[model samples]
Target: MATNSIKQPLWAVVLLLPTLSSCGSMAAWWTDIGPSFVLQNASTGLLTHSLCHSNNTPLYPTDPPVAFKTKYAPKNGTSLTATGWYDTMTTWASLFYQNNNDDIVNAVYKCNFETGTYEEIESDVISDRSGTPPPNAQTGLSVALLGQQEGYRVFYHDRARALHTLKFTQVENWSYGNPISTSTNRSGLALGSMFSGVRNVTVVTPKDVANIETIRLNIDNAWHITTFPTPLRGSNVTNLSNLTSLPYDTSSPPPFSLQGWDGNPKAIGIAIDTVLTRHIFYIGTDKAVHSYAAFVTGLTESGFRAQPDQSNEYWPLADEPNSDFAIASHLGSSTIRLYYLSGGQLIEAKYKNGNWDPASRLVVANTTVFTNNTGPVEEDNGLSTGAKAGIGVGVTVGALLLITGGVAAWILRKKKSTTSDVEAHGDEGASTTAGGAMGATQPASTAQSPDVASQHAEIARTGSGLSTEKWDTDVKDMALTPPPRELESPNLASELPQGIDRNELPTKHHITELP
Candidate 1:
């Protein structure tokens, strides 16, 4: 009778594997979602990463993710942005973040696609070729790689309330652009940027807190700015803070449950797809993801005004997010991924195959990558909202382990013995970033130190060191838009389908946009 009691649980465990495997297709998750995302450890405030690998799925909590401390620890609610080059032949990634002192720090890493690992190359303050770095940045900052010798640009808001740019190349080094004059003061510190072909576009919310200011670097190598009105500044919408604003009652959809905008950091997530359609994402007053798509016209002031397609339905899954978020799209790919931190959990949403997937996952936020954030992880460095969330998760996990621990232990022993170290010994070195779209990779150690080029060479190499003719509308011969196009779905509606959980309470908006 004793032997049978012990054996029964093991049989149940064997049966549960297939059920968990099919619950959500592991293959489908990777194909539709993405490869990885970057995060700031809420516990330690250091940079950490969460990724998907062939050998592992969310089903297994056995082998935890390894986190290497990447020196830049962002402020409590700072924005995080990344840009890099990735293709079959090359991969390089760079992460730009605002540190505690409000300085813009750059961390470059060499990535192995085969083993899903990041090897640090260099970490330092961004400076010009003259070895002069730019001014300290406020919370809102963004970066982009503008192809070849055109180099990369990091745009940030300064304490003086001015928008500034740091443009750099491998040979010419770094130089500061004149402070950009805005149509209005940036009442909301929301800023985001994307680069493609011959144009780079950045958008910020001016003092009005309602309209969007589009800043463009045209084919002529000059900056042109335009402001567009959005439905954001509705009568009920007011600048408040998450702490004070009326929490949104997400028991049902809007009209029935929409709340006003509180003082939440409007961290913008932006990406460009293969169709020349540029999309921007931000947290609405209701704390859901509101999306707008436009076909780039390549003109100066009205560059993004033409063919604007706004989605009527907001992605409700993106509720109550922290100020930092990201959007990433692969080179010439139709898929775009959105990521944000909510209650210390990293939520991922996807817009692909001409529709937004109503399904979003609480990704690595639940995994061991967040070991510190997954419990009452009080650390000396600092832990805020994310750490508190772990108390509940810790209790539930403990209850579950008490029931299955013996069965799990025996099974784990059997599984571990059969699982051998058979991953490829060597692979090409590329790039790593938390917020940008990255190429597919295999599992590898995060400890390897790969050979890297000189600092200048890294700047050029990270962006593929290939520059085409500058985008000139007058240049009839240059190909600015790629030829591939998606057949427009005439039946497509402007709204996204809602994904709701009846048991959970919804967030109310009370956030004020911080400059």
Candidate 2:
């Protein structure tokens, strides 16, 4: 009987090969799920698809992502954290934090679809018990690292009492592997008084991945700024200040008189509208949410500054969100969202129509409390309700269909209708041509003008608009290609022995300003 059973499975396996092979050859699962994978690359001002959604379901409200908690968010609410999203072939949201021991911190984590968890793909600490803790380490400690181009990490070192930026690229196993990269210290950019007022960094995509820059705000001085461009040889931190009390408008200078913030701005977040200009949002120390329009003017002079508008542009004054907390925009748009944990309950808020709307407390289940040691295993798909409905309907009506094995499972689809929709959903014949000639890679255009096709191909590799040959090597390995091993030279390692010259100014160059 056992031999017969084994033989039966073998026969079934032999019969199933052709059917499975046919299905594999014709389907385009990756392209259909492309939109759900929108990744924002703050460096290049571009967005790409994520690896997680490449061959599976798209991420969205209708599809609803399954959250996989990392082994990072603590069992208790004690540590401070930082997070941001990047656009590549997919949209990936990354949250970084320090463990109570200051020595523990993962560089990057990827969201897992099958298990609905965030797993660490890289850890940055060089030594187990290294470095002095940050200022808030003893009484309170936090780890905040903003992801940037060329695998650079912008984090605050509390023990050292400074904000330092380190840029390193990882290859092979992410166990803090051999680095083939570089680093430049940016402590001066957010030094002393600067760090005093600043709380968080909000990455903005001013233009497509080519002209990406960070807008730094000194909450205490109400100062705003961006970093100097490359080949300057060191960190050239530029202070963006206009003598006028109000903020500068990206399109045109602010017109007329405006009521400015009388109190110091504390908590800050930035978002860009559909037109691609930036809008600055912050909560003043006086407990008021404020808005500003930031711009760099006097292209020939050192005159970059922020114009704080206190007109009807501000929101949630006095009565709402009066505590210290964190704010982040949702995955896709400029609409800002806020999160805070009170009494072990998580609550959220949003900015709408120039006012803040409070969201009900997020009821995280008892069994689902994401802890430090244990990660978020899987998300509840809310399938029990569907199961109940299926049972209530009974199975009698489909008995004949089940016996004939002819009932096809329903396929999920997005609502957007356009040429993109057609490409995402695929032609009716996509399922039958996966491994076939239908899905073969196409030759990129060799047109003259600005080389848009090559640009897309370059974006596909480095997740940026700026072309990178070194990053192309990293991309090839991440794509599961066999990478050639070479010796790790000291020069190839990422390090900046000499710190930055804090006083350098940015050069003036103009692109067509957004309308």
Candidate 3:
């Protein structure tokens, strides 16, 4: 009897031990905390700086040093609006220079970020050949990027008034070389300002080639042979027309397309989040920001396929019209930020979980127009917003653990009398028969360990509360101001460009006429 009583309690303890240890396996909870801080110029206070790599190589001062300013001069009483940037992110940044002086012409220029200047890199100057008279030239540069593998990949708009893709490899610098001779007026198709996978998309136009029907560079042939129109025929690129914007498809469709997007013509190519699953970012078109998702595979000719099937839907962006938008991904968060020129000043908005939050103004320009105000800016820095948020959550979790421990102790003590007496009575008969065992197993020392039922309750309350509290804290902190950075400067510029001779610059929009 004595031995059985001892074994029973020991067995019970063993069984309860597993239940207690399992408490640590609770579900993990996370929430989007957004950017910890937004750094801007003290003068113009622009949040985004248009980013580009001069040679696909890392440079000094600007980290990899891939972006540049959109400075321009007026011609014949007309604003010669243009956009320029270093194209690739390698050791050499090919400059995508667009001289949108009403002709939709482009030239690849090589820029030296170390010296802070540029020179025309390409021998040929290419212009849009839509065969239709030019509607104002697309303000942004076109880029054809190489994916990670050796193959031909093209990103351009087709005649259906939609964006299209043709995957091939082995092409290099088709934009500068004038490789394809199609007479399509597919002007302003440069590599996207952003990256997808291993390379940027390549843009090209047919150079008066006959019988070719379709024009695409053969990437496997080193971009030298423009004969391989195989992918174009296989896909939808065979008969092209009405191509609008060129956005890299980063969706499950393995190169999802951004098609039929027309709103703000200036809203050309927007930046995308390379690290995000949804990959949300903004591009300016008709002065509005359009959102996109990358890496989705189910997209077909009919549009985004249904999920389970991963189907997609088209949402019209009517909010914040007439403002140019530049977006960057907030590191490690679902939040995508949009920096735009609005109300004559710089402003920002954050998109998360498919919703565009209200716009927050970042710069104030109540008066004079400034140079470098032609486009929005962006940057990718080494600072960490996710880490700061993690630290905050850790502190909260630690506090919760401490408090739960104290509460568990209080509960145990409150139930101690009944639990201890029951345990003592159970052992008394067997212990008294065993010589001197009663004193050895005194009631004080033999009190039952807290019940499993009580422990489960404690865990349920603590774990659930901790998750909820953490989420609430994250949402609240999204509205909190971000920290300051030493390297980042405000987008605001106090000085105008050197070429802006006071007499030459437009004065307060004195009703100008075209040439």
Candidate 4:
């Protein structure tokens, strides 16, 4: 009877076909319904709106009010507790802050110069225990966006008053390795009042490569610079063991030391020029903006030259008590911008074409407009929101298609051995053809100019723009001599060591007049 029933229907089977087809169609439509809604919501949410559309007012509706007031805002009073950098690749401003609670937070925001609108894509706390327990006011934060891997590296002082660094890649969350202990006891150095008081931190990667270097004042009351090669390639962690300290004359004697000026809690700024020259700006105890330059020649006697004597002029806010400064440089450009707080307003100066334009004092933002308290901020002349939305949609669709196609291919291979065999054979021929084509298209080596060749060789030998071989040699030579005893007072301005002449110290350069 069952066999007869199965045979009964050419007509019946034909009639049932429409219903089965309809069911399949309904299933497909049902599967697509959820995604359709998601796409709609995502598109609408990402649509760009102008914050300054109505008037030429600031982007934030209320001054210093939390929701979307530039890249960062201080929760408390007018001390700028935030710093930001512009990412050219992403066209977004990445901001980091030490909030009122002493927690570290970072956010990425896009600005629309056309519409004057600001949009935040992501914001989250970087560290909950960012040296808040005792509330160290001098514990500033520094962030460097590594162009090689499109990731961020952060440096800060922890609650234990230790110097620590952490990294964040697009694929993974923030991960930190062992903190570099800056304790005088651990380092066998005398760091007086600057213990755990981090005035500033700056990081740079020369030639846009993996060789990362950082300069900061540790608990030892001295500015120390360290370099790490391939900093992003390790077991998802920074290897501090490879850290090599650079030379800075912060010894105990009056002639060698800047008399602990490097340890000041005011502010310090570092920038790399187009030719890989490093410029360090700091506020000296004399209330002057002191500047120093390090040429990329091998790290020998002439590695870094101090122009302290040249920096005699005072900056607008540089001499003000409790004032801090920040610096930013355009990638692949000779222009460097300096920012500082003056009368609760953010001001800027530009260093371009071999001169610092102090008269280019542009008012970046008024702290009173957003809040009464001062906040450190960074700006970007970014793209429109509509452009960003288009990019976001395209990326989302591409990802979905890739995932769906991969799943379909996997399922088909699992269901049919014949299909797998056919694909394997095709892949083998394709791979062989690709290899032969690649070999055939290989170009002959082009000879580089003598100047270019020499530059490349130097980069290879030193693993950086600055050669460390001679510097290492100098260190080894110094190690042969007996170490100096710890100074009774970290500040020994009154007591001058014999046979040392302070007049012969490296001269400074005017901050705004630096070449």
Off by over 4 Å in 4: 1-74, 77-90, 128-138, 148-150, 184-262, 298-304, 308-314, 317-319, 341-346, 364-515
Task: Quote the lDDT for 472 in model 1.
Answer: 22
Using alpha carbons, what is the TM-score of model 2?
0.37
Q: Using alpha carbons, what is the TM-score of model 4?
A: 0.43
Expressed as tens digits, the lDDT of each residue in 1-515 for candidate 4 is 00011222222211111011000000000000000000000111111111221110112111211123423333332112222221111123344544556555665444332222334555666664333233233344555433222244566554444455555643445555335433211111101111110122243222111122344432343444443322222221222333333222333322233312424334445665444456665444454555556554432212334554432122454435323444444322344544443433333445553565442222111113222232122221121232222222212110111112233344354444221122322221222222111100001112234454333222111001111211111111111012111111232111111111111111011111111
Cα RMSD of all models vs. native, in order, equals 17.4, 19.6, 29.0, 25.9
Every candidate's lDDT: 0.39, 0.25, 0.24, 0.30
Candidate 1 — which residues are off by over 4 angstroms? 1-35, 52-65, 71-76, 87-91, 112-115, 127-137, 182-184, 203-207, 230-264, 296-314, 321-323, 341-345, 362-515
Q: How accurate is candidate 2 locally (lDDT)?
A: 0.25
Tell me the deviation in Å of residue 44 in model 1: 1.1
lDDT, candidate 2, 129-164, per-residue tens: 223223224111222221122332333333432223
Model 1 over residues 1-515: C-alpha lDDT tens digits?
Answer: 00011122211222211111100101111211133445444433444454322111111121233333466665544456665432211233466766667667676654442233455566666633343334444446677665334566877765555566777665655566544432224555666776544344444433334345556554344555544433322223222211112223234332211123333345665666655466655565555665555663432112233222234231434434423455666433356666554443344555654656543333221132223222211111111122112111212221111112232333345334221121221111010111112222221111112332222234322322222323222212222144422221111111101102110111111111111
- Maximum-TM-score candidate: 1
Better of 1 and 4 by TM-score: 1
Give the number of the best model, judged by lDDT: 1
Instruction: Quote the lDDT for 419 in model 3.
Output: 13
Q: On residues 1-515, what C-alpha lDDT tens digit does candidate 3 reach at each position?
A: 00011122222211211000100100001112111111122222111122112111111111211122323211111111122211111011222222336332222233232232333332222334323223233222233332212222223333332233333222322221222222333322222333222212222222111111223232132221121111221233322322232222233233333322322222332333213223322233333344443332222112111112111112234234332233343222334544444444334454554455454433211111112222111121121332222212212110101112233334355434211111221231222222111011000111223452242123211001111111111111111122111111122111111111111110010111111
TM-score result, candidate 3: 0.32
How much is 288 displaced in model 3, in angstroms? 6.4
Candidates 2 and 4 compared by lDDT, better number:
4
lDDT (Cα, 0-100) at 397 in candidate 3: 12
List candidate 2 stretches off by more than 4 Å: 1-79, 82-93, 112-115, 120-149, 157-160, 171-267, 272-276, 296-322, 330-333, 340-515
